[model samples]
Structure formats: structure tokens, C-alpha cells
Target chain A: MRLKTRPSHREKQLSEDKNFLHRFGYAQELLRDMGGFSNFAISFSIISILTGAVSLYGHGLTYGGTGMMGFGWPLVALFCMMVAASMAELASAIPTAGALYHWASLLGNKRWGWYTAWINLIGQIGIVAGIDYSVAFFADGLLSPVLGYRMTETTTLIIFALVLVSHGVLNHVGIRIVARLNDFSAWYHLGVVLILVVSLAGFGKGELQPVDSLFRLGETFSDKPYWLAFLIGLLQAQWTFTGYDASAHTIEETIHPRVRAPWGIFSSVAFSFVAGMIMLAFVTLSIQDVHAAVSADNPFIFVISQALGSTFGQVVLWMIVLAMWFCGLSSVTSFSRMMYAFARDRGMPRSDWFARINKHYRTPVAAIWLAVILSFILALTDYFIKLVNPDTTYTTLAFLTGVSVVGLYVSYGIPIWLRLIAESKGRFTPRHLGPWNLGKWGRTVAILALLWIAIISVVMVIPPNQNAGIALIMMMIVLLIMDLTYYRHHFPGPEAALQVSPEELARREAEFHD
Target chain B: MTMLGVLLILAACAVALAIGIIANRNVRAFNEETHESFLGDRKERDAFEDPSVS
Candidate 1:
């Protein structure tokens, strides 16, 4: 029969996206046009192999020689892949902003989510500080001579502020610009890696270390036992592996988030592992003297300069610095979104302001500035510490690096652990929860991931970074006090968002309509 | 010393290989249908049916 057909919506997916978010009792405030690649792009940009691998290249060389770059990297990447896969399953099941916090809440209780949110926030703050500060210090180390300017502590702090502000403004405007930049960033990072690998290989024909040199392990700087020092150096890979959770944080802005977000989380880590290996292989092989490279102001740049001469090294160093800039910009986007999502449910002080999305931009403007401010303050530690004792400042850098890796891993571990316990008691099956099921391997993978996290959490906080260990314990105690006295009486948790009716959710979403 | 070094390298490689086997099984679960119990909380479902948002 020639009956009138209902006008088919060109985008059936938009309706489904809104429906999914409504099921969680929140309106889709952030705009969502992010395709699968864009979803992958955010996480990859944050991982930024060039950013972390190069910045911490000297750390790895000092603690475990070159073996950590060769062996320790894959070892940590293996565990990180397991972590990413496990997280992908949760992200697929409950695709939302603040996905880690919500996963813990639903899997266990509000307490788990509360702890996860605060710890994740701390990690984000540390990462934002670390990434921006690294760019400043790395730039200072590589370009001070070339640019004919000094990057003293005060000067570098100023540079850090300028970098943080640009990222804040870019993120405050909208996700569209940030997403485009991240996509470009992903390509920029890989292209630079390719160029460096090829250039170093061509230039370093006779200068490169033997291939077997990659497996050579020792503790040249620290007097710790070889095994212990190697364990500490593994922190380098863990630090590089941080922030892939950016994919989960941006779920609301991603199209088909349940499927796409999980892919984003896992694929970013997978790609980074391979690409980072190749880049590190060439860079480390090009090192003529491990001791000199390890002791240099900027070891990664030193190796390149040694191989390809000062001029070529300076050009390559500039390229790497640009990648770090992109890396920091993406970190700001990820960090601010986590803050906004946590605030959405009164998880922070003055939640009303932080949670508000700008009408014109559909971006979290207040949260973006909050991230920038917090990181800027934290970045000042370098200036103050260097002013006091420049010799011990790298220890402070190690603390920041430790805080980020340990904090994020703790947050990631909680949900996976809680989910495992729930499934063991037959609360739910992996098949029923999400599209990304581990099936029978759920227990084994979860256990392995939990074990990996436990080991690194301890190893990362040892010796020189004991300040991080103290900070973490104190942070936990303070959060517990705050929760027991304040949040317990007031905060109803993310589950409160889901207490809305279908009609009410529709009305709330309508508020975002143009 | 050389033998121990080879063993350390091999042990790390072995760990990666074992993890890789599990990782393969966990690859790219897109294009699969997810179960509809995401907002599976019984209380939350009642909230959806009820007239108010708490």
C-alpha cells in the first residue's frame, strides 16, 4: 500500500546518541560529531610517544641503560595493553564523560567512584603540569643555545604559562577546533617519528651502537641494585603510557561512543607501542656514548645532534618540541573534560560553575581555565625548586611523573577490580555488559592488569620520588576526611543523574537546543 | 653475566608474548551488538518510569 512513510531522519544515530545519554540521566550538553578516528586521535595525541619518550629518554638511560628502552618498554606496554582492553570493556558498557568514575560507581558503589574521581583529578593535574613543564624545560635544553636566549627557571616558567594559556583558549572555544588539532597532531607525531628514524639511520651509519647494545642493562647513575634500578626505570614506559584514558573522558563528544570509544582507548595504546619502539630503537642506537647521552641537558636531542651534527640536530629538536606543544594542547582538552564531568555531579567545590557548558561553544570554559591555573601553579615548582637547588630538581620531575602514572593506574585499577569481583559473584557477565567482551579471559586479563598496576604503583614511588609516596598517602587521608565529613552528607554521586524521568531528560536536553 | 643478560631480555620478551596472546583475543570488538542493560540499575529504571528527577 502507498501509505505515507514517516519522514526518515537522515541521522538515526543522533537520536540513539541522545537516548543513550538520557539513559544515564544526563542531557547531551557537549556536541557530538567525533567519528571513530577522532575518538582515537584524542587518546593518541595525549599519549604522544614523542612527548614522553623523548622527555624521559635520559631517565631510562640512567637507571637501566638502553635495555629499558628495548625490553622495559614492551614489558610495560604489554601490561598497559591489558589495562586498555579491560578499560575498553567498561567504556563500551557505560559510555559517558567521567567514564572511569561512573564505571566504579555502577560496578561497586558511590565510594569507589568518589575515590576514582579525586584520584583521577590529581593524575590529570599532575599530567597537565608535567606535559607543559616538560615542553618548557625540553625547549630550554634544546633551543637556548640556538635561539640565543637563556631558559632560566624564571624564563621557562614564563614560557610554561604562555603555553598553558594558548591551550586553555583553544579548548575554551570548542571541541571542533581541538578535535581537528588532535587529528593533525596524531599525523604530526607519526611523521616526525618516521623522519627521525630515517634521518638518524642515514646519518648514523658508522656512529650507531651495535644492535645487541639495546639489551645491555646497568645502573650507571643510581647505586641501587641492578634489578631495583631497572624496576624504577620501568616508570619511564608507564609515564608514557599514561593519559590514553582521554578517549573515555571524551565519550560524550564522540559519535557511537559505546563502540567507538573502546576502539579509541585500545588502538591508541597499540599504535603508540609499535611507533614508540621504532622511534626509540633508532634514537638509542644512534647514541655514541651512553654516559654522555645520559648526563646531557637533553639526552634525546644530544644523541641526534651527535649523529647528524649541530645544525641538523637543532632542526630535528625544533620538530620534536612542536610535537610536545601539540601534546600539551591535547592534554589540556582531556584534563578539563575530566574536571567538568566530575563537577557535573557536585564532585568538586563550586560544582555549579565548573559544570556549566558554554552555550555558544558547547565547551567547559570554567573547567578549562581551572585546569590551566592548577597546572600553572604546579609547574611553578620547577622554578622554585631550581632556585633553591638546581641539582635536585630532576627528583621533583620524577615525582610529577610518578604521581601521574601511579594515580591514573590506581583509578583504572579500581573499576577493573570491582567489575571482576562483581562478575565472580555472578552479578553480570561480560557478554551482557558491553560489546567489548573478554569472555572467558576476563578473570585472567583482569588479574594480570591488576597485578601490573600493583607492581608499578610500588616501584614508581620508591627512593628519589618518595615525596610522591608521601603526597599520595596524605592526599588519600585528606580525601577520606573530606568525604566522611562533607561529601558523605551532601554528594549523591553520579547515579543521581540517572534518577531523572524520560520526560524530564527530554526537557533537560531541550535546553541545549539552538 | 652475558647469560643472565640474555635471560633477562628473554624473560621480558616472554612476558610480552604471553600478554600478546591474550591481547589478540581482546582486539577491536566494534561492529558487535552490545546488551541493552547499560542503565541496568533497578532503582534507576524506576526513576525513568516515575514522574520526577531526584
Candidate 2:
């Protein structure tokens, strides 16, 4: 007879983790190997400070000038940490995949989950679309001499498809590979940023901007009020601060999730908040001529080339492109995970198709493609729009950013709001509170977070992004219609998973093992 | 001054987060205790409802 042996501490911990998840009515499907750092890395990689900061640097300069660049960023960062802290508490209480959806379903209602899941997914898809398209745009502009042609709409679509396809394939393989890359990406962002900041200070031959100009209290462009433009400039940092929820959304695959995942959420934002400020400050200070840099077609590139030679700048740009690629890769991973979790509860239109996990790969093959294809379609919106209305300034680029930033903030707000309401009513008892809780500070943070979301959502949709504003209103009407006609009858919501008995739950999990 | 204010707020948040980490380190044990309490209460209720307990 084989001797009975005690389970190792790691094995015991895994069992406890699985049981904790089972209470929330989920099977341990995704491999649970991600530690605190790995959990933090996924969110950090998705945040991709280099990608957002560099991509939107010109927008900041044109709209808000030095004051906005200096003041607006950290202000946005401060509010974003409040948002992260609020989210972290919820992430701790119920550390599930597609965390926002689960939190809403339990705290509020199924309809809330449905809307939150859809909006969050839309935001993520928009992010993936925007990130990859920026890569193609930069590659065409910066490397055109070597590549031999500028990117037309047709060529741009081709490049966009290629980039999305690569991310899809990488994600389809498995989370292990994706997590490893995300870990490397986190370090890469910090290291490259350190290099870039130092390079700008040490290698620049150009005259620096005035020291006092950093706090100059006015806008460079006055087409709009200084305050309005400054708020609009907040998009540059607001966009970067997003996707830190990737940590929450991947908690099922993380160990000791209640504590680790919350840490992941806050740490990712806090790090990006600091690192991004340093990077932008260096770039702003290195500007030889404000007019020349701001008026140039691509201010970020112009600033780099002016500070260092074009050859050296090109090297830096290539590194940034690679960072964007990693950003897209990590994004698709989070997108598919959320899609899979939502579909698992029959929340999506074709739930079963998207919810399937490849037995061998243990990854959602169909959902990965769903994210790729949806984002690709959104990416092409600009191409068709420009072809139809050549004079229009309303491109889908702003639409994508608006949807991504505003839609995500809205999705994030629903759960926070619901939790606040539950607490105010005294319905949310201590058992409902998570281990890594904000306690008395929770309500205060949630209120601030919602107020910030409301402010930014309005700012994101006005003026140049009016089309996005219209689109969002249309989306709400469509969702309400769908809920009444289709989902009301057909969809079971999260109860499909949540109502399962203990015996049934074990049987379903066993099927995976076999 | 704005920079200083922002940095100050960020630092306060960071310190609070660090405190949360140390405070919540024993979630696994807390979860176990909660589960045991729940099961123990259920068993007591079951025993109380037994017909022979009269």
C-alpha cells in the first residue's frame, strides 16, 4: 500500500484558494501561479506608462501647455489612486475574474452586471484598438523611409489587422506565456523610462525651457477656456491610469488573491503615477523651442529628435513601439479573460461560443478572436469616416479614447456606487467587507471616485469627441431595448453559476480535471 | 505648490495602502475561522430541530 503523505504548504494554500473561489461559485480553471509581483505586473504592463505618455504627449502640449503637463497629470493621478483604492477593497472581497461584473451582480442586480460587463468590455476593446493603431501610425511615420511607403487607410487597416492578429495568437497560446511577458514588460517600462529621462537630461544639445515655466498658470492654446482644455488634457494621464483593473480581473489566477490582488491594483497605479510624471517632466524640460515642438506634426517625436539626434531618437521610438506591442498583448489577455467570465454566466450574446476553454491550452480561444475582431472593426471606423467626410475633425481615435476612458470609468463607478449604497443602508455587514478593506475610508473614497468619473466622462465627450458622446447615448438606448426584449427572457445572469449546489459544483469541476 | 499638494496626497494614500497590506496579511486564517463559525452554527440549529431533543 502507498503511504499517506501530508500536503505541502503550497498545496494546502492552493486548496484554500480554490475553496475561497468556490464560495463565489467559480471553478479553479485558470492556473494559479501568479504571485504578488506577477499580479501587479499584469496591471502595470496594461497601464504601459511609456505607451500612453509618449502617444499623447503632443495632445497635452497642444491643448494644455506646461501647466497642464505639470499640474494636470498628478491631479489625475491623485484621483485615480482614490479610484484604485476603492476598487481594491471590492477586489479583495470578491476576487473573481471579470471582477466588476461579479461585484455588481452580487451587490446590486443582474442588470447592473450586464451593463457593467458590456461597457467594460467595450472600453477594453477600444483600448486594444487605439494602442495597436497608434503602433501602426508611428511605424509608418517614423520608419517609412525603410518601409518604403506611407500608410494609407487600406495600408493602415492591413497593419492594424496584422498587429491585432499577432496579439490574438499570443493570447490564444496561454496565460503563462502572457504573464511572463507582462513581468518582463513591467521592468522594461521602468528601465526604458529611466533611460529616456536620463538621456533627455544628459544628451540634449538644445536649450531647455525656462525653469519657472513648469508652473506657468495658463493654456498655450485658447480655443477653449483654459480650465476646459486642461480637463481635456487630463485624458493623457486618465488613459494611462486605466487598465490597472487588470489586476482585479485576473485575481482568480493569483495566489492569496484577497490581499495580493488589491495590492496589485493600488501598486500599479501608484507606480505608473510617479513614473509617468518623471518621464513627461523630462520631455517637457528638454524642449528646445516650445513653438517648434508644439507646432510640429508630432511633438513627442520632434522633442526627442531635437534633444538628441534623429538616429538616437529613432532608437527610442522603436523601444516605445515595442512597449505598445506588449501593452496590446497584455490588453487582449485581460479582455479575453473578462469576456470568458461574462460568457461563463451567459451574459454575452453568443455566450457558449466565447466561454469555451480549450482543454489542452486552458485558454479561451474564441473570446481572444472576439476581442481582436471587435477592436479591428472599431479601429477601421476612422478609415471609413475620413473617406466619407474628408473635412471632418471627428475621428474615431478620439472616440476610442473617449469610450475607453469614460466607459471604463462608468463601469468602475457602478460597483463602487452600489457598495456605497449597501453600506449606507446598513445592509453591507462586516462579512461582506473584504480582508484588505478601506474600512471607514471606503465611503469617502467611493464618493470622490464617482464625482471624478462624472467630471471626466463629461469632459471626454465634448467638442472634438462629440461623436463619442452621441455614440454612448445610443449605446444606452440599445442596451435598455435589448434588456427588455431579449435578455429579460433568455439570459439567466450570474445566477446560472451562482445558484449551483455544492455537489453540482464539485461535479462540474471534476469534468475539467478528467 | 500644486505639485507639492499632489505629491503629498499621493504619499498619504501610499502609506495607507502599506498599512492595509500588513493589516490584511492573515486573510486565509480569517476565512477559515469564518467558515468554521458558519458550519458550527448550522450544526447547532440542526440539533435544536431534532424531534428526539424533547
Candidate 3:
């Protein structure tokens, strides 16, 4: 008899990943160009420190003073790490695109998965909109001096659309290019943030704040109690820590995903937490005058410009804008993957088109365009609202950001809670426990994640001002209506539709190789 | 520096150090275990991949 040769490590890994995909009735449609580092890079790029920390610094300072930066950031980061750890465990167990939906389906039922998928889809789109709009704000700032005028709402909208389209085009190219960009983005964020911090510390012209000021709980922009203001200030950290799910959502394109995906999710949050805290300390300490900084439209820009000369500050701002653009681009990649996966399992409308991978590029081109177009529409709506009612006091960014956080965190919590219940009852045995299993610590972390998400969900919906709760209610109403109508009759959930019997999966795998 | 500022700095250091150590240890353990397990499974995989097998 002829001797059979053993497959190499790389081949075994690829074969195992392919078999996992076959179990879900997929045929390795997307190119698997991402390694562990690239997987981590995607999540880190999405959680770009330059994007959230810079955009929302003034908001945090206004609500909770410098103490928010000093204390609240680490506190929120700790809770977010807990949430990420729990989700990482689940991601390792499933290792699929649209990870949250698949986890919910396997852990709970199809109905649960359907709702989670929709919520995750909405959240991803919102992230694209929010990140791009922030990019437009910075881009306009960068161009205004050269253009000899500040950007009007219309001009800003144009910039936003252009950025969105550029991101969509880049995503359409292929996963390889996207992974490369994300890898570059990760380094850019780390290097730029460190450079900015060091520059501010070394060459800052302004007198540093008294050390107590960093920890002093001072006045708020809102009339609420000090505790509530502090709680509200936590939004900056919470938002910054999001989109780590991008790692899980792109698990299908990752090598050694069972081990790598979980580490990607965990490490992204861990690294961001440390880097963000250090950056916050440098920026907050370098603030010359708290009142002047907070009063300016962009406090971060104000602080940098005042301390480090306008030219250097502008250069830093340009770097941040580039980082945010990369952030939005990576978000599109992640959002399109989730949309394609959902569509492939017949969970979306026009499934046939959205599920189609470009033969040449090997990408979900249609889904990428759809995500960007929706983001563009949302950005346009925000611009139009500002133009028509400049004095009406509507907070478009706040509402959109709230919807995004609440939806994403709730979707994250559902599967975690279900997994906790199943584990406690001794019914949740994973078919293949990935390398990063939490073992005994899993249950405790899951409980804490659920609690943290619950608190943030309530905080997200209860707006600080009048007319702020409308978005949350609207999202609920839409979900309710869907549950009552279309989804009730037609949705069989991801498990029923995607899972294949062992024999059928074997047959399909053989055919796929052929 | 104020006590709070010192405290904040110390806390940041502690968090960074603790998480760094944990992540490093876990990653090392994973690599070692995976290497051993893959070596142990080579024969079984060879048998499984054989076309003449079941």
C-alpha cells in the first residue's frame, strides 16, 4: 500500500478553517489574506484613538472635567475589556463572519439571532456614518485655512460623501488591500498618538495644569447632578472602545481563526485601553486653560494649537483626519462582511445580490456599496438638519452615536447572557474550544459584561436633553414592527438555514475542492 | 503633583503592566500547547487524509 503523507501545519489550518466554513454551507468565498496581526489591526483601526478621543474630548471635559480623563477612562476601559473578553470567548467557539448573530443562534434560537443580526447591521452602518462625519469635520478644519473660508454645511456634506465613496471603492478592491491598509492604520494610530503626546509634553508653550486639576471633579455643561454628568462623560471612553467586534465579524477571513480571532478581540481592547489612557493623561495635563479649551468647537485642536503652534497643530490634526478616514474605510470592510454573511444565510432582503462575491475581486462589492450609500444618506440627513434648522438645537451626532452604541452593546450582551445561562446549567459544551478558553473565569466575566452593557444601554437611551430619546424609541419601534410582521413569518434564523448535516457538508466540501 | 494625579498615573501603570503580563503569558501558553498538539495529531491527520481510508 502506498503511504499517505501528513499535511503540513499551514495546510491543516487552512483545511480546518475550510471545513468549519463548510459546516455553515459556505465555500470560502472571501480570500483569507488576514493573519492574527491583521485581524487585530482591523479592530484597532476601527477603534482609532485619533477618531473618538479627539472628537469627543471636549464633550468629556465639559461633563466631568479633567477627572473624566484621569479616572473615567480607565474605569470604562476596564468594563469594556470585560465585555470584550466575554465576546472573545464566544468568537473563538464559533469563528464565523457575523459572529454575534451566529453565537446567538447557536446559544439561544433563530429569532434571537435574527434580531441580533439586524441590530449589529444597523450598528455597523452607524459606525461608518459617525466615523466619516467626524473625518469630514477634521478635513474641513484642515482645508479651511487654505480655502480662505470655513466649511459650510453643504461643503462638509460634500466632503463626507467623498470620504464615504472613497472608502467604499477601497473596500471593493479586495480583502488583501483592506488588510494592508488596516495594518498601516494600526501603526499610524499608535505612532501619531505617541508623537502627539510626546510633542505636547516636551515642547508645549502653555503652563501645565495643577496636578489636582487632573483629578478634581468640577462643574458640568449640563444641569444634572455631578454623578450623572460623570456618567455621561463615560460615553467618550465607551464609544472609543467599540468596533472591536470588527475582529470577530471578519473571523472567516482570518488564519487560525479559532485562536487568532479571540486574541484579536482581546488584545485590541487591551492595547487601546493602555494607549488611550496615556494619551488622555498627556492631553489633559497640557491644557492651558480648561474654559477656553472646552468653549472651542474642538477642544483637542484648541489645546494642541494653543500649546504647540498653529502649524504643528494643523499637521497633527491632518494625521488624525487620515486615521479617521482609515477608520471609516475599515468599518466599511467589516460592515460589508457582516452584510454579506447575513445575506448569504438568507437573513437579508435582496439576498441574492448582496451575497454575490465579485468573481475577479473576490469581494462582496454590492454589499460594500450598500453600506457606504446608507452611511452617506445618514450623513446627508445630519447635514440637512443642520442647514434647515441651524438654531433648532437638534443633536444629530448624539442621537446617531447613541443608537450605534446601544444597538451594538445589546447585541453583544444577548449571546453572552445566553452563554452564561447555558454554562451554569451545564448544557453549554463547545464542540471545539479554541485555544483561548477562559475556563472557570468565563462565567464571572460573562455576568460582568451583561451588567456593564445593561448600564450603558440605559445610559445611551436616556438622553441628557429633550427630544434626545426619539432615536432609541424609533429603533425599538422598527424592531417591534419587524418582529410582528416579516421576520415572524419568514425568518428561520441563522442556525436553521446555515447549518449543514455532517454527510451533506462532506459532500459539499468534496465538490468545492473539485 | 497632587495625590490624585499620582494615583491616576500609578493606576494606569498597574493596568498596563497587569494586562501586558496576562496577555503575554496566555499567548505563550497557547503557542506551546498548539505546537505540541499539532505534532501529536500528525499521524491521525495522515490517516484521515488518505483517500483509501473510510
Candidate 4:
């Protein structure tokens, strides 16, 4: 008789993972160089606390005062953790590059999945544009003294384009390099944020705000009700918590994804929550004059420069600028992977080209460039809007960011809600639970996540002014029309286009069940 | 800080700790279950494919 030697543990795990990919009708295309830490790094890097917490601190302070930074952050973080937990369950279940799109389709239906994919794609593009532009804005301020000239909007736009292109080039190089940069990015964000917080706590020259002042209700800088202003202030936390889906989107490139990807999603949010709150507290306490800080453009920058002096503050700001650039780069990586996966399932026009992997670099070059180009277009559109009507500039950009955040959260909520329904109805039950499973807590977390998304979706659209609300409604109408006319007929969804033969799927399923 | 601020900070820590513990437990349990199930499945498949292996 022939002897059969058993495969080693690592070999067995790789084989099963590859078989799992085969069941989805995809070969192992992307290089799987990412371990658990690298998997976590991508999401952590994309959700760079330096980018959103510092950039948008003024917005929160304007509407909700220091109370938002002190009290509102943890509250928002708790809710976000719930959402992240729900997403982790789904990530473990599907563990594909399509991520949310694949989960929605498998749990719900093709139409739902198509809408989810489009919304997520739009959100990814918007996020890339927003993050890169924000970086450009900061870089402009940082370089103005060195350049001896105030940077204009056109100059910033040029810088934004260059940043976007550079991110695209780096992503095209390979996943290995991207993973290394993201690993570096995770530590850099934590180290720099810690340094800044410590500096503000110890050496800040301004008189610190009293502890009670941190939680006391203050002015909203608006005529709206206090509660409404507080909700608006929550945007700082909401926006920062986004793009953690980066981990899920990179599942195909991650090792032992069924376990690692879920943990990646959960731990990124958990760490960000703790670290973000500490940073927020320190920055809020360092603000000497609330009115003066709020009145100044880029209040966080103003506070930093004032507290630390221009030279030291600029040096610190350079660190943030680098982190933001890394944030934008990681965003592109996530965006391109989503685009490639969606296209691979024939969800977009010219699906074959966008889905093509570069043999030389083992990266999706076409998808990366497409995302880069679309983001550039979005940024250019924002620039033109400002040039044409400066009065509506803030409102327009706010509307875009609003749409981005709403779209992504809505997409996230849909699958979680559907999963909840599926589980309750006994329609779907995961045979192999991922390491991040909430178990009995899953239902409670999913329900709360859905509710939170529903509330935030409304808050996002109605912000800044009524024009934003109107624009949001118009955009929804456009999406619906496009869905009915084109996508409904052409899109095959993830499973329809990517699933293997029934017998093979059954065998794989049976093996897992065993 | 106000009582509310202190409470908020304490609550944040509490929530973080609770979730961290839950996550750690889940990871450990999941690893054990997955490893055991995978080995069982492989043995069953091997036995079925080759009678002599049994």
C-alpha cells in the first residue's frame, strides 16, 4: 500500500485557504505577504488619527466645545466598536477581496450586493480625494514659510494631484512594499501621536483648561438646538472611525484571513479608540482661548503653533503631514483592491481590464490607476466649484464628504442587518466562526450598529446647510436611476459571476462542516 | 474635570477592557476549535480516499 504523509499545519492552512478562494472561482492572484500585524496595519494606517482628529478638531470644538472632545469621543468610540465588531463577523465569514460586496450578496441578494458595491466604490473614491486634499492643505501651510509665499488653492490642487499620483505609483510597485509602509505607518501614527500628546501635556505654554471645563456644556457657534450641534460635532469621531474596512478589503492579500482579517478589523478600532481619546483630551486641554482658536482657520494647527512655538510646532506638523500622506497611500491600496474585486465580479464597465493583475509586480495596476484618476477628477471638481463660487465652497466639499461617509456606513449596515435577519430566521449560520466572533453578543451589536448607521446617515446629509440635504437627495435619485437602467441588467453580482460549480462548493462546505 | 468627565473617562476604560477580554477569549476559543475541526476533517477525508490509511 502506498503511504500518505500528512501535510504540516502551515501547509494545510495554505491549502485550505487556496481552496476557499477556488470556491469563489478566483485563483490566488494577489501576493499573500501580510501577517496578522500587517493586516491590522493597513486599516490602522488608513484610519490615521493624525489626519482626521487633528484636521477636524476645530469642527467638533465649534459645535460641541471641549465637551465633545472629552465626553463625546468615548461615547462615539463605543458605538463604533459595536459597528466594527459586527463588520468583523462578516469579514471572517466571507474573507474575500470583495469584502462587503461579497457578504451582502451571499447573505441577501444580487441587487443588494450591486448597490453595496457601487456605494462602497463611491465612498472609497470620495475618501481618497478628501484625505489627499486634506494632506495637501496641511503641506501647503507647512511649506509656506520655507517657500516665502502663501500657497493658493490652485497650488494646493497641484500638490493634491502629485500626492495622489505618488500614492498610485507606490501601490503599483507591489503589495509587499505597501504592507511594509503600512506597518511603518501604524507605528509612526502611534509614536507621533503619543509624542504630541505628551508634549502638549507637559510643555504647553498655555494655561490648561480646568478638568470641569472639559465636560461642561459650552456654545455651539450656531443657532441650532444644542443637541443638534452635538450631533454635528460627532462628525469628527465618525469620520475618523471610517476606512477601517481597509483590513477587510485586503483579505485576499492577508495570511490566514478567516482569523486574521476579523481581528485586524476589531483591533484597529479598539486601539484607535483608546489612542484617539487620549490625544483628544491632551489637545483640548492645551487650548488657551477657545474663541480665538475657533475663529482661526485650522484651529488645531493654531493651538499647536501657539503652545509649542512656530518652529517646534512646524516640526510636529511635519510628522502629521507624513502620516497623512501614508494615510492617503493606504486609502488608495484599499480603494484599488475593492475596485479590482468589484470589477472581477463583472460589476463595472471594462471589468476584464480593471481586474487584470500585473504579472511583474503582482499588483492590480489598472485598478490602482483608475482609482487614482477618479480621485483626481473628484478633487478637480471640488477645486473648480471653489473657483466658480467661493461662497459655496465649504458647503460643496461638506456635501461630498457627507455623501462619502453616508455611503460607506450604509453599505456596512446593510450586510450586518441582513446577517442579523438571516441568523434570526435560520436562513444562514456560519459553520466556521472566525476568531473575532461576538457569539451571543453578535445580535445585540448588529442591531445597535444598524441603528447607529441609520442615525448617522441622516446626520451626514443634513449638515452645514440645506443645500447639502438637497444634493444628497439628488445623488440618491441619480443612483436609483442608474441602478434601474444599467446595473440591474448588466451586473452579475459577486456570486453569480465568481462562484464555482455546485458540486465543488458543496464539497468545500461539507469539509468545513466536518 | 467634572464628575461627568471623570465618569466618561472611567466608562471608556471599562468598555475598552470588557471588549478586550471578550476578544481575547474569542480568539483563543476560535483557534482551538478551528485547529481541532481541521484535523478531524483531514483525517476523515484521508481515510475515505484511501482505505489502507484507516
**Candidate 4: tens digits of C-alpha lDDT, residues B1-54:** 478777877776776577667766776666534421110111111211333221
Worst 10 residues of 3 chain A by lDDT: A1-10
lDDT of 1 by residue, B1-54 (tens): 435545644564455455445444444442345456554343432222333211
Q: Sort by DockQ, best first.
A: 1, 4, 3, 2
Candidate 1 residue runs with Cα over 4 Å from true position = A1-10, A385-393, B1-34, B40-54
What Cα-based lDDT does every candidate model obtain?
0.80, 0.78, 0.76, 0.78
lDDT score of residue A143 within candidate 3: 91
Write one digit per residue (lDDT tens) for candidate 4, span A180-285. Answer: 9999999999999989988998888877777767786766766668889888888788878889899999998886887788888878988988888888888888
Candidate no. 3 TM-score:
0.89
Scoring model 1 with DockQ, what do you get? Answer: 0.17
What shift in Å separates residue B3 of candidate 3 from its native position after superposition? 4.8
Collision pairs in model 1: none
TM-scores of the candidates are 0.91, 0.91, 0.89, 0.90
Candidate 2 lDDT tens digits, A44-147: 98888887777777777777887766787777877888888889988888788969987876666666778889889878887888788777766666766677
Name the regions of candidate 3 deviating beyond 4 angstroms.
Answer: A1-8, A430-432, A465-468, A497-514, B1-54
Separate DockQ for every predicted complex? 0.17, 0.07, 0.08, 0.16
- Give the chain B TM-score achieved by candidate 3: 0.53
Candidate 1 on A1-514: residue-level lDDT in tens?
A: 0112243431566677778788788888888868788889889988989888888888888888888877788778878888988898789788889888988777766667788999998888888888887788777776677679876777777778888998999998889999999999999999999999989888664467777887676644767788988998887888999998999999999877777788789889878988998898888888888888888877777888888888877888889888989988988988888889989989889999999989889899999999999888766664575577767735546777888888899999988887886676566575555655566766787789999999999999988777678778878899989988998667777888877788887776677865
lDDT of 2 by residue, B1-54 (tens): 556645654674575466455435534334533421011111111212333211
Candidate 2: the clashing residue pairs are none
Considering every candidate listed, which one attains the maximal lDDT?
A: 1
